[model samples]
Target: MSGLRDLTKTKGDRLAYTATSSSTVNRRKRSFILSGLVALFILVAWLSGYMIDPSHLSTHLELRNLPPSLVHPFGTDWLGRDMFSRTSKGLGLSIQVGLLASACSCFIAAALGLAAALGRTADAVVSWLIDLFLSVPHLVSLILISFVFGGGMKGIIIGIAFTHWPSLARIIRAEVMQLRSAEYVLISRKLGKSRWWVASRHIFPHLLPQLLVGLLLLFPHAILHEAAVTFIGLGLSPHQPAIGIILSESMRYLSTGMWWLAFFPGICLLLVVRSFDTVGEHLRILLDPRRSQE
Candidate 1:
């Protein structure tokens, strides 16, 4: 009887484990689908903006200040520019800038993070730098850095790259610190493998998922900051159909009641930003071992 009871318990446990595994697989599938859809939307938006001709964005006096209509989906700006084209172009530019800035930032974070694993002195210095950067407000530092770099696309990208890495770096540092004490790493060292070899082979592979997620997470902040700086005349040129410039120019005409000028572009920016954020979050869940199973 006791043997039969043990057999029943084992079967129940197996069934429970199978059910949990199925649930985890289903959750991962849903996350992948959602991430893919969001990424597709972003790619389409970027391509639409990139493929549009500058002439299409040219001012048309006849269409100036027109309200949203079937012909002009986002309506027309005071200069008679199609708000749709302008917003698309601006978002594309923002995405481009964000991509470049985020990549650079990730590189910085990864380097510093790995360096922090080298020694106590290196860790201390990296920690201090991280703290120092974190102490200042992001916007203020971004503005100052943009001002120092003379506030163009280059300046904006550089400013964002420099400013955004501290937090991610700290995360990477902690991860690397833990990884250093991992049993496999210790065994590698004991086997006379060079630190560089162990790091590149073992540590870096472990860090890749974290880095990818961090890069995606950084995109929204980079795009928003770029827009903010450009809005205040410290980012992309005003002549460019940047979202910031579009919104900034729209402010004067808002009193004149041309609402679509700011409204559509603002909504588009928010959607794009939110899409990036969603993708990052989804990727985080997919990549995080603890969350991936849940």
Candidate 2:
């Protein structure tokens, strides 16, 4: 009877393990599917603007400031431009700028971080530089940089790229420092492997995950900062139908109760930013081995 009881308990444990494994797999599958949908939504939105002819977004004074209707889905702005088209274009522009700035920032962060982990001197110098940048308020620094660069697309991109790297650099530096002390790293060094060789083979593979997460995480901040700077008239020109420009122009008529001018674009911007953030978070969870197991 005892043997039979022991066997029964073992079978129950196996069944529980199988059930847990199946549950985890299902959760992971759902997570990936959700992430894909978010990605598709962002892609479609960007394409909607990018693929459309610029002439379609032109002003038509006759239809100006019309409230939301079937003819003008998101309503016409004060200039009679289609709010839908304008919002879509603005969003696409934001995504473009965000992508460029985020990539540049991530590149800067990765380079500085790897350098900092190279030696004590390099580490101290890079750390000091990071701190110096971080000391200044980000928005102020961004505006100053943009102003110096003449306040346009180039200015916004450069400003965001330069200002956003310090935090991510510090994180990467710490990660590299930890990886530098690992047994395999020491072994490779002792085996007379060139630093570059070990770095490319061992260190880089380990760092790729962190680098990607940092890049995606930076996207929303880049977009928001670009919009803010533009709104303040230090980022992009008013001629551009950027979300910032749209919102800034909308302010003039807000007293007249034209709320839709700001409402639709604001919501679109929020959704785009949130979508990027969600993608980054989901990627982080999916890539985390410990969480994946659970």
Candidate 3:
């Protein structure tokens, strides 16, 4: 009787484990599908904006200040420019800037993070720099940096790249520190393998997922900051039709009751930002072992 009871318990445990595994697999599939859909949406938006002709955005005084309609989906701006075109172009530009900035920041983070693993002194210096950057507000630091660089696409990208790396750097540093103690790494060290060889061969492959997620997560922040600085006259040129410039210019006409001027563009920016954020979060969950099971 006792043997039969044990057999039943083992079967129950197996069933439970199978159910959990199934659930995890389903969750991962859903996450992957959602991420793919959001990514496709972003790609479409970027391409539409990138490919639009300048002539389509030319001012039409007769169509100025129109509200959202079937023909003008997002409506017309005060300058008679199609807000849809302007928003799309602005979002595309923002995405491009965000990509560059995030990639640059990731490079910085990876370099400093790997360097931190070299020695106690290197770790301390990297930690201090991380803390120093974190101590200040991002927007404030970004503005100062942009101003220093004379505030253009170049300034904005450089400013964002410099400001965004500390958080990701800290993550990479912690990951490397933990990885350093792993049995494989320790054994490689004992086998007369150089530190650089071990890091290149064993460590970097593990860091790639974290780096990719970090890049996606940093993108939204970069876009928002770029828009903010530009809105206040410190980012892109006024003639550039950037979202910031759109919002800033819209302010003057808001009291006159043209809501779509700022409304559509602002909403579009938020949508793009949230889409990237969602993709990053889903990728992070998929990549993380502990969270993947949940």
Candidate 4:
């Protein structure tokens, strides 16, 4: 009778544990869904504001430097331009640059990584190049590259795209190399299938997840670097309504007690970058099978 009671208690404990674990998982899933929806809403709102009208951000001397109020939610800058409008436009432009640069960088990494995995000679050369690029400070390299290209939107895009690929390329090359040595790849080779054909049909599909994750991770870096270069006067033109330009212009007026000029725009930039980082982290967690178990 005691043995029977002990067995029943053990079974009850197991059921309780299972219920608790399931509840925890349900809560986490709900949290993830809520986070995703909020991020999407913020993105859509910003995009709508960006596409609304350029005239909205135009200078209005009379409205200039107005403090935050119902009339101007983010207040007005020294030039009397709507701070909210300027911030949205500037952030939108930064997103454009980040998307372009991140895409280009990913393409470069994928191409070089595939090339390296295709041959030993190519692998050695690519490895050396990766090392060379990594040896230099990214900012210094970005500055030199941007300055050489005349320091504007074009320069910033090209500079960021070229400088950001090395680490990703290394990761991709290692993954490809491992895949190349797998049994199926070996069998495909033995069956008279060309390396290019196998890689295109098999390897590329496997690479998509990694490539996507890398692209998302690269976005925040690209945006931040673009702003940094612009702030240091080696990036986009001041005439452009970029976050860097807005922040740079705000510096001169900060001492005059127009703290909103810098504070609002800077905070907005940080929020956008952080949002991208969060999305990327969540994406990685979702896509990784081992992490999904956790």
Candidate 5:
């Protein structure tokens, strides 16, 4: 939004910070480590699910409320379901929702953002609509939309995409507007390149790194939000295993000694959220040229 912005113009420390953020630089090592950890969890959860039928059901009322021990690593719930298996499976479900929802949101963001950047009447309408959506809390918007759409995977995807795209669209619009006049972009147009050609080749490519960083940040939010909705009984069906559902069911037994029922699943959720945030922060730094320079 600032007039004729230049990446090089910065306070000393700011420039240093930017330099440190260059995505293509030294931090690849740390980024890889963080990413690998997430991948490992996903792989383990996925493979474990196929090998074991979590629906077999456990029946041990006496051992049901036991603490974490060798036989039941994460302990047992009220129904005697293995917290380890349920928690692991729940993670898979959570990540699935997060991945699908975030992908949909990012796609919507890109499309709407490009539309807004075109500077047309349609762009104005989209701007106003996006603003209206943004005015409400994202969680509330998602909840309302999900309820309207009939609470399930379809609803979750639609709700998340609809609620979250506004911010990304606005950010991308600003970026596109800035890039539209950049040296590379202008040069492409001056050479008689098609509008689409210039935007696609010069403008969009420039936005990719930052967009990726933003997406990584968005993933955790989507996952956690989905879990929250489920916890409140508005998300996934109770028949299916999910982190929220597991915890929500566990609430009835909290006073009992079976603390591990909620404990382990909660830990799994925490790790996944933290992992996403860690990667997102690192990506934000790496993608910003100024940070890289810093």
Candidate 6:
């Protein structure tokens, strides 16, 4: 009778284990599919930036602004340059702006947030300064800063970096506050670990999971805002190859029935932003220590 009871228990455990494994596998498979699509989109955008071999086209008005067809896949623009090439180059610049601005934001948010969480003294000082910066509308603030700093790519980078750090800073401050209360921190204190040592070894690692997510999420926003500032003629120089330049230039050609100038670049911008969000979000979920696949 005891042997029979053990056998029944074994079978129930196996069945439960099998169900859990199946569910975990299904979730991982779905995540991979979504991550792949986003990765492919980013790869294409990266390639578009410099996949050009200047060895291909030459100066010619004869082929200018040709419609999309077999010879030119994405059509041509007013300058007789291949729309495909210009798009790839324009996307490259936007990618540069996104990444550079994001790096600046990550560092700024981490330092200030961590500082604020160190104690009430540090928190009060940092909190007051962050709130002051957060009070104004971001776009207005960006333009105002640009007007001061010569209103070019440099201005755009600086302005975006300034305005975008606050959200992540606030989130990081909250995360740090929670982490400071965790038992491990108290244990480290009991063990005689220096405050800075404890923060580096214990607190920062826990904060990273959310910080990574915020950085990627901020990327798409940075790209869009950069393009907007550029479009208004207060950001990057008009002559530079940029999606905003292409879009702004298209307005003049609209009455003449040339819409491809705006349409193709717009699609590229949207897809790139979507991929950043999806892949960044999925990666964050995977990296989260407390998040379980099942």
Listed in order, each prediction's TM-score against the native is 0.94, 0.96, 0.95, 0.91, 0.84, 0.89
Judging by TM-score, tell me the better candidate of 3 and 4: 3
User: Which lDDT tens digits does candidate 4 get at residues 164-225?
Assistant: 99999999999999999999999999999987888787788888999998998998999999
Stretches of candidate 3 exceeding 4 Å from the true structure = 1-10
Q: Model 1 clash pairs?
A: none
Model 1 stretches with alpha carbons more than 4 Å out: 1-15
lDDT of 2 by residue, 1-294 (tens): 999999999999999999999988888888799899999999998888787678769878988989988977789888888888999999998898999999999999988988875679999999999999999999999999988999899999999999999999999988888988999999999999977777678777888899998998999999999999999888888888899999999999889888889999999999999999998988888898788886
lDDT of each: 0.92, 0.90, 0.92, 0.87, 0.78, 0.83
Kindly give the stretch of ten consecutive residues in candidate 6 with the minimal lDDT sum.
51-60
Task: List, residue by residue over 250-271, the lDDT tens digit for candidate 3.
Answer: 9999999989889988999999
Provide the lowest-lDDT 10-residue window in model 3. Answer: 111-120
lDDT string for model 5 (119-228, tens) is 57757877887889889999998999999999987888788878887788888888877887788777877889877777677777777876787787788889989999
Best by TM-score: 2
Per-residue accuracy of model 1 over 1-294 as CA lDDT, tens digit each: 999999999999999999999999999999999999999999999989989878879879988888999988999887788888889999999899999999999999999998887778989999999999999999999999988998889999999999999999999999999999999999999999987788788898989999999999999999999988888888898878889999998989888888888999999999999999999999999988799886
- Model with the higher lDDT, candidate 1 or 2: 1
Candidate 4 Cα outliers beyond 4 Å, as residue runs? 1-28, 31-35
lDDT of 2 at 190: 100
Clash totals in order? 0, 0, 0, 1, 18, 1
So what's the TM-score on candidate 5? Answer: 0.84
Colliding pairs, model 6? 48-88
TM-score rank, highest first?
2, 3, 1, 4, 6, 5
